[model samples]
Target chain A: MSRPVRVSPQELRQTLIEAIVEVAPDVDPTTIDPCEDLAEQLALDSVDMLATLVSVNERTGIEIPERDYPKLATLDDAVAYLVHAAVRQVDAAARQEEDSSI
Target chain B: MPSLGADMESGTLLEWRVKPGDVVKRGDIVAVVDTSKAEIEVEIFQDGTVEQLLVAEGTRVPVGTVLATLQTTSDESERAQAPSAPPPPTEGPSAERPRVSPVARRAAERLGVDITSLHGSGPNGAITLADVQGTAGSTQAARAVKPDEAPAPSVAADRQAAMRQAIGALMARSKKEIPHYYLQSTIDLSGALEWLGKANETRPMSERLLPAALLLSATAKAAKEAPAMNGFWRSDAFQPAEHVHLGVAVSLRGGGLVAPAIRDADRKSVDELMASLNDLVRRARVGVLRSSEMFDPTITVTNLGDLGAEVVHGVIYPPQVALVGFGAVGERPWAHSGMLGVRPLVTVTLAGDHRVSDGAEGSRVLALGGRYRQRPEEREK
Candidate 1:
């Protein structure tokens, strides 16, 4: 299967906030800054984060590994990881196509 | 609405899932309540804007008490502000209000009631869980049930479901865990009928001895002779029952069963036993059986004779080491005084838990029925 491209930093933060909003709509998004640690600040447990992750995956095409979850607790973390990962995938696909062309 | 739990009478407003002025749809979980059964997320009954959250996180309110207001506009928060409401209904914390806003902050400074759940008529939904906690007695109305649901917290509903769940878990665990041994015996019941008939002629219908009334009488007599077969098993210790509480298993037409005990079954006579049995059966049918009635069974007596069944090998009700299954009786042959004779007979089955007793102990208890020569004489004995 073709790997999906990474989401933008803004989009990633929006995704996380949307998950929280779905669970707690009364909460103000401004209070839940993506740069801040979700666990320390929002008191998000691993289970809560898993729910958010599930919600995010449902909306996106990313295939994040379970092992990679610790790297994406914050919005900046998710964006940086997704962007770098997407670039590598795109480069690998382009190289494969070139070899096939030859 | 689906209930969060059976034991959840009320919950602490840990935090509002939605804030004032936020829009929500049906099925939206609007807040979290700390139910004794579980920490449940209270869902929106319908779609609307959150006008104000009446109770804050950590602030307690009984179940069905409005934690927040949902209206087409912000004006709907007033519905919860009614003067007639029950006051400061919080969960987890039984006595004090929740700790949320500044007064709650000062109080939280002193650990007062939390009120972050309170939506500010002050604007911007800034009233913290602390603020609501500070304004004690103002939130007293919050403790009350809504106008629509008279008893916001149906303790009975909680109790019944809790009782069922508890009964469910226990029976499930027991059937899976305990090794049961069942034994049955048929006795000449002709004497029981004639004895009861003569006794009823001298007494009123309200006090007349019925078959179960007689069986319970004999059961107590039997239990006293065989005390080892009564009571429960605990870790490293076995507790033998002192009082003779007779558990009469009443089968509801709906198909499940409950046993409401006749307390001090040994103390009552045939007439008194019948009256108590009638009251217990009535309460058991309605699911309003009390703790003592539902529990406190030193032994259980389940009658299947009414259903026209001849014999039944019953399951031992847990904790109590023995169960006596009563079945239909018919006239049968018996060798009496070295001669063959036909006599009315009834069969009693004893299901005992082997962990607490042996087959010999169960057999010994059943033999005590033979000691009571007359059914009427049992009442006086």
Candidate 2:
């Protein structure tokens, strides 16, 4: 139950678009795509993008502090972040399990 | 950017609020358009001096095109017109409060310390301490008590919850966000009712005068008498009003409250007042009210007397400082010509905003009640 599993690529695409629409209602949602950068396509500035980050944090509760925001430039970046954190958690849990068995 | 989308897509240039060179704020309406929707007004969402009108009013362009560019006043904003620049999220205060962030909305949650329901000047209407402290109320309701321990809330516990919630939202702003105080007096409603009874005898059912209409008259007169009560409270300052919008709080049947204001109540006649009061009540219950109906109420009056309430001292709805609450004008024994007699009486509670006037000044403004000297009685508990 604790092992990391791949987050579905399809789910990642859907949630990212959902997060953008929730963050920026005025932007035409039909034009939004996961691959399209928010700043270049939807005209989101630093503050508007911060609001989007807040929505993500509120939904996922992954404390992606502001300093790490530069790493999240595209939709794949978000998926990678989630997967990498899950792998770390699972690796720590496996070590604990191996110690218990020994 | 000052963008004018023509109404007919090609209607003639009707007029402009400012000539090409005039300065305008972000939301100021720049030009009126003759559009397919009708002669529509076009507004600018950027602050800059208008350099030119891009197209003559009669030119027809597809809806998706640019109306006008505000001219390169700042290099920072030249990019704003381009979707690529990411229009700096100004987040100027929207009149209708929007959904707030769960975390930034702490002032309201602090209970009696913040008012999130008011038009906030903060980021996206985030509840601010000043707004809460001004009203002196919070989203916090009174502590729960056992049924055996304390009296029930005046309205239903659940509906009271909604009522309190709505009241909490509305009052959070008026009490905390706006500077308010009250000025009250007892009206000798005895003569007015007598006059109203005679007026009712001659008039048709639809035209009869209720006490509310007369109360409306006095309030309008008093507000006009003291224009200071008509304005809104801005940050750390008070702006006396130019319009006298009167809000009357109508109690709903199943237990909720609605205060719908009659616009320009000062200029309206008794018959017009009666009609508007009727309309405000009907639409208020069904929830079909137009947003304009709630926007600018310079003064508000709340009457709980009809619900067996002796008197209700009102909370000022922020910005506007005074609220007059009407109590039952019941039949009570009184002295007429120094002899004991029965008469109908009305008690009015005036809640004032000290930001503008003090208790002494409030009493003077309340002198409108003096004209109604025939009120049945004056007794306070």
Number of the predicted model whose lDDT against the real structure is largest = 1
What's model 2's lDDT at B161?
Answer: 63
lDDT of 2 by residue, B305-354 (tens): 65456778888875567887887667877777989887787778778777
For model 1, the stretches where C-alpha displacement exceeds 4 angstroms are A1-102, B1-169, B338-340, B373-375, B378-381
Stretches > 4 Å off in candidate 2: A1-102, B1-163, B172-184, B372-381
In candidate 2 chain B, where is summed lDDT lowest over 10 consecutive residues?
B1-10
TM per model? 0.46, 0.45
Enumerate the chain B TM-scores of all models: 0.56, 0.56
Q: For each of the candidates, give the backbone clash count.
A: 43, 21
TM-score of 1: 0.46
Please give the TM-score that candidate 2 achieves against the real structure: 0.45
Worst 10-residue lDDT window, candidate 1 chain B = B144-153
* Candidate 2 lDDT score at position B150: 17
